[model samples]
Target: MSAPTIVAADLPAPADPLAQVAIARAAFASGRTRPVAWRLRQLEGITRLVEEREAEIAAALSADLGRSAVEAWLADIASTKGEAEYARKRLRWWMRPRPQPLPLNQLPATAWIKYEPLGTVLIIGPWNYPVYLTLGPLVAAVAAGNAAVIKPSEITPATSALLARLIPEYLDPEAVTVVEGDGAVTQQLLAQGFDHVLFTGGTEIGRKILEGAAPTLTPVTLELGGKSPVVITADADLDIAARRIAWVKLMNSGQTCIAPDYVLVERSVRDAFVSKVVDTIRAFRQEEGTNGLRIVNERQFDRLASYLDATSGEVATGGVVDRDRLTITPAVVVDPDPDEPLMTDEIFGPILPVLTVDSVDDAIAFVNARPKPLAAYYFTKSRAVRKSLLDEISSGGVVVNHVAMHCLVPQLPFGGVGESGTGAYHGKWGFEALSHRKSVLSKPFAPDPQFVYPPYSATALKIMRKLF
Candidate 1:
């Protein structure tokens, strides 16, 4: 059956930036969102939205991103539903305050941390993975009982418009608002002073977001991208490594932030690994019945094409570029110059570069020399090698024998360090990131002692110091 038509008129009407923030602030102030039942209901709403509107979401994603139905479900729809369900089951435990033991001198006082919402927050989402990244942060916001504003990326208009239409239908419209626009609109919303802001996009844009939020003193969480690298050791299962790396590298046409950007293989097995990867890509394309992967826009297409033009590496297989179609055959370049554009830039495309290293030490040194990545993947059966990679690499997250799986598990915190990005959010980490842990202390007046006052004798001072 064909999908229903979604015109511009069908989308939710855009709201003024000032009024959007004001309405969310009013909703938060009304105390309607503070209760656990309300928070859980919002989570349930999100799960229902993903469930009931599955086909519509897939259609929107296909319109905006040219994604297949299964890809859309795996990357955005299922991932989001999993996050909401995970948080919904354990939110009460996450919300409960834990008692803290007081010092000997303060025995009569009880201390604990109370989790509370940080008023209203803003979620500025990226073009890639629009549904998951945008609504993923919203799960945290509502889970912590804060009102929110969702700013979907303008680059993917269909997904943006679909989110604008569906969010209010599923969520509390008064507590959660969707404001659709470009970067300028995001800047205007930032000016309105939200309690917190979570942005998922590229690094340069993350810097711009930081600058925009600085004046308002608003806390921001950045889920930015970098050249996430994958290392293949001689001891690693060559076929398994090739398939895993190829699978994730081709996901969303390799636009994923945690997708393996480049491969660092041990020189002894570099040729075998590269050959297997090339064979895997061919098999995958043949299986999918597609000649090329889709690029989001002409600008991104031109940028990716330029990298291929300037690369000092051998284009091993599939360097075909069709600008008119905005699609590029998934190309595997063997041993590109380290300083070349393909090596230096975050290749947010189907282009994958394989660089050879002498040993695992060289691989570790090579990754460490550059800015920390959002994720680092090492494929090896050697526990020593795995431990070395885990111990030495300073990345947002690491996966052994797998690529980009860390982000899928809600138990792990997902965010970059150094230049990649800042702050983490998935499950409990997300809840705490959006919530303010207020410290509470209660004391009885009957235990008040004159010796604890401002004036003190020498003996009292000594006693106080000893007690403290």
Candidate 2:
């Protein structure tokens, strides 16, 4: 079957949120997306979209967030492509239903779970990683054989417009549609009652999404943000840890939800780790030939600048901020007060705070006392320390000896707990999250036991009870 023709001009003004959902739902009802071949075709189309439009995607990202070509490729283009490729390769196994053993009571019965698509779903993307966050969830929706309506972040207008133009050309236009708008538009879409809603954004906005979907009773998967912490033990390789932390933290000017929001190091090695991190940050900036990192907008720039202003701790390096340029040099804060905003709030900028702890236990205790984060990172060589940290703290996911690498792993379920967020989706987890597992049981005609009838004798009742 040929792909449907959908373009910006074909869509209604403001995209008529209800009409978009209706179109996808109608397409889903036709059952064209149910076949494995069609699903694979859609997934491959996404891969083609990335491959053919690499330059356009990179340029859009740069225009929206000032992300360099290399950063754009790694975070938006490559990561999304990897997810599509991974899901496409394993979709067959994921679609196959596994045979399940029956209980003793049902002697001649067979049971298994079949994964079915939720008619039509909505994916609301965030601006920080516009292409990846938007397309990433779409990958899951498509892999699950469901129709999808994608709402790219309005904050990244350039990327959003690009997606609106490109998605229909690449994927099944009727089955998958892109609706571009702001928070009000998102609220309007949520009011239309989708099968499932997956939103990636801040906690406050997540709450609103949940509230908006409440009337429709739509199941929602919120990939919200929080103060994801990094614990550095004495036994960890400080050099490697510093490099990894600095590398991820500086990516996209630290706008990532899973970026190390703050670091807690053992008191003994605190000074050394801080020094290494400073050197690493400096070296990275020098190599990139950029002294200051660009913030997404003036509001975010002011917010990050305020954190620097309020902090009572010593600024180890890179505290300079250019308000007019909307950029702040990567700043490292040492021993910031626990009650201050720098430590309390999720610093979604190019600022790093390194706090000294008495021991690994202290670091774990500190993390446990706060709301659960989206992710928690630990750098330790000792197995005991690693195990202890894993068992003790609660988070969406964990990465040992590195930071933010878990998000790249397609096999792992990525999400948050408590205030961080709810639900998980990546590869099979993503497919499962968007797909419903329907339980099926088959029985032979001979297995219609008379004991199960309403009119039963004492012996029949006794036998039924025993069997049950």
Candidate 3:
């Protein structure tokens, strides 16, 4: 199927976006964000605020996405809290300035790298895992000492409302502000010049952000979604892999940007892995409350449904969809053609497609044929196979013998190449994005010796040449 454009009526509002940008720029101009201590204190404040209002955050997420409080806490609130602390604990190290030795000719001078804050960052968030995606980057911006204006996803209104209303009260309203609205607002925000922009959402929207920010030549960090792959090898532990994968996946009814969209299993172990995954999913749903498998909203429900109807592949397990309950049964589609609708787009729902491949090379080729995914996973005990796979395939990040664990690690850089995304985040990369490295050099107090001065006599030229 051809990729289609979404109509204006279908799109949400971007009402009053520029005002937020202006507020943020004015705040940056105030120089309140220039100090490292102020940024660290702000990050700490975010952490304290989340802990104090955990219940409120959970409720907001639950109401918005029909997500359970437990799920909301685990996915959104906890993530934000962790990110805030992560930034806070490391702020000193991240902000420390190094001392450089001066040359013998200029002993009084010194030179060192300084991580200066980028002015007025604009963060455009995604609907899937809205709180984490929005706040995670915000945490990084705070850490780097940049004033940020956050644009939460309009599709998740409760979240957007909560963030916009509460963020200013807890955070430095001058340093951090939330602008709640749709694409129109985002375009308006992009129209205003920002030092940098960080966006997390679909590829189509990411493209619009890029185009909108193009005039100012403002750099952007896009945390867009793609069809991230998970390969289940024949030599893998089916039961262990199934349980862990299902646990991480069924968190938000599989409405995760980095969730394993599809699985590639060797034909020899296909049935066993399929059975394990199905049974595991069943167990997972039984534990969930009535609203566990929420379809987000009507629009997403329709979009997720389209994949099921348009796909030519036979359903391996559940194909059920109930709008009243706002749920789709944990679905597994087997033997799907790579060209089918189910395989075409990033499936950010409970549906899981299984593609059978004969060998690891075939799986690698399959993933490489499409746009570079945000992540890739392989569940195998074999070290050699893991190394070989890692060496062959390129992705934003990887999880060896597991799925989706790489993002949790604070050390590694996370972002996609080509279509998936442009830049990485987490840890130092976040600081790097928000900080500018301005090289500083000092010269000697003495009238500096000039070996190559313009007015050179023959004797002076000879001496200069000898010195050279």
Q: State TM-scores per candidate.
A: 0.97, 0.97, 0.91
Candidate 1, residues 1-468, lDDT tens digits: the string is 212322334434535777877888999999999999889888988988898899999999999889999999999999999999999999999999989998998878899999999999999999989999999999999999999999999999999999988888778887888898999999999988889999999999999999999999999999998999998999999999999999998999988899999999999999999899999999988965656899999999999999999999999998899988899999999988999899989999999999999999999999999999999999999999999999999999999999998888999999999899999999999999999999999988886778878778998898899999
Sliding window of 10 residues with minimal summed lDDT for model 2: 1-10
**lDDT agreement with native, every candidate:** 0.92, 0.93, 0.81
Q: Arrange candidates by lDDT, descending.
A: 2, 1, 3
TM-score for predicted model 1 compared with the true structure: 0.97
Model 3 off-target regions past 4 Å?
1-17, 99-110, 288-292, 455-468
- Model 3, 144-218: lDDT tens digits are 888999989999898889887777766776668788777898888888878999999889889999999999898
Task: Give lDDT for model 1.
Answer: 0.92
Tens-place lDDT digits, model 2, residues 94-148: 9999789988998888999999999899999999999999899999999999999
Clashing pairs in 1: none
Ten contiguous residues with the weakest lDDT in model 1 = 1-10
